[model samples]
Target chain A: MLSKKAQYAFRALAHLVEHYDSGPVLIAEIAKKKRIPLKFLESILLELKKNNILESKKGKGGGYFLKKDPSQTYIATVIRIVDGPISLLPCVSLYFYQRCKNCNEKHCGLHDIMKSVRDATLNILEKRTLKDLI
Target chain B: MLSKKAQYAFRALAHLVEHYDSGPVLIAEIAKKKRIPLKFLESILLELKKNNILESKKGKGGGYFLKKDPSQTYIATVIRIVDGPISLLPCVSLYFYQRCKNCNEKHCGLHDIMKSVRDATLNILEKRTLKDLI
Candidate 1:
């Protein structure tokens, strides 16, 4: 259900949680551990850092680490930072909801079905903290 | 989340369900009605037909029809026909799972988390039938 970017981002965040007390994790190391492409992981980390889900450094021992404890980070928060809205349809999205242009009724069957999918997916993503992923 | 192919297929199938008692729906007509690219939808219906979720007619007045009543056609069945598998991670996949290469234990943390996601997503998609989409 997660996007490729979101999957990679969650995996990388997990690695940091597993090693958070040690120090920041190098993007390359996280990529290797997670089996994600180096280039793709780099951009994901940058986005995570930008959103403050993660923080980074630039020195010899520098890399990326969580801005908060693993328990403090929700998987949904990290996912949205990397993949935008998680809802399959833009109109059913909590962050970007706008009724679909062709929806014939306020509770159109199509929209209702999509909304069920969205709500079910979000309930799982939002309840679990990054601590659970680790 | 729905794949692009699954999204197109669902729209096409909904069109078919909407006009089932009528003659076959032209690919172009369904595409236009649903706002999907004609060519992309052509392939989706082909795949759906291969899986027997849909049946097609080759000559004039022939398009596609559900293999069974719309209520018998689960959204999950159509989605699986159009998309390889829905689970995000390979290990948690019901159809293609073979533990992650790096997972240390049978009930490893990562798999457990992904399993929860898969289970939750499947529960919603599997419950809704194509009848709901129509």
Candidate 2:
């Protein structure tokens, strides 16, 4: 399942994508528009900014904006930023691989099936851009 | 992410699938082999039995066994029994559908992508049986 943070991040991004050409949009404006908690959204947007997915301005009429075009950004990147691996099992993860204790990946049935599930999920997430989502 | 309960459930089922024709396997033995906490494995096996994925025999030389042939049991069914919806977004879930708050399913981009994700996951999970995993 997608974490709440990831869901909120997507909603916030969708809002920004809608106002991409309108210059910086305020955090408060985004929180209100997306119905995300202000404080929670503050950290989420800050994280996105730190990751280069978004940028911000300061002072009067200051707010945030996407660093790249929505078409260039992907939902998979947003999910990874908020929620770690997309794989259900750590052993099957490509970006965040971890060996499952007491199990041999080569011979394990669960590992094989999980790898397939991960591949399937990645196919959709990698191909679909934020523009598609927006 | 898969819940701890779901993971343990799979581990337990994998162990049982390994010993499918070897009579009832002890919950204690499964817990020991899979490195799952004994108490946790107890409840997990009980739940699987309740779902008809497993059958338990009490007393001398008794333990647990798969209710159906391992080849007939799918990972998707076990996951649903332990973790509810397979869909990332409740709105896209077939068995556990729920409306996303403040969103219109027909027009939401997240909904579209999440539905694809759910379908992709279901495809691999539903087609692959416990036999495949073992």
- For all candidates listed, what's the TM-score of chain B alone? 0.89, 0.95
- Candidate 2: where are CA atoms >4 Å away? none
lDDT of 1 by residue, A15-94 (tens): 89889899888999998888989999999888888888889889899999888988888877877777677776766889
Using Cα atoms, each model's DockQ against the true complex is 0.50, 0.82
What is candidate 2's local distance difference test score?
A: 0.89
lDDT tens digits by residue: candidate 1, B3-121: 66776777778888889788778898988998988898888888888888988888887788888888888876776776777776787888766565656546466567667777877
TM-score of candidate 1 chain A against the true chain A = 0.87
lDDT of 2 at A38: 100
**Which candidate's lDDT is highest?**
2
Instruction: Report how far residue A58 has shifted in candidate 2, in Å.
Output: 0.7
User: For candidate 2, lDDT tens digit of each residue in B28-111?
Assistant: 999998899999889989998999999989999999999999989888999899988888877899998888996888899999
- Residue A82 C-alpha lDDT in model 1: 73
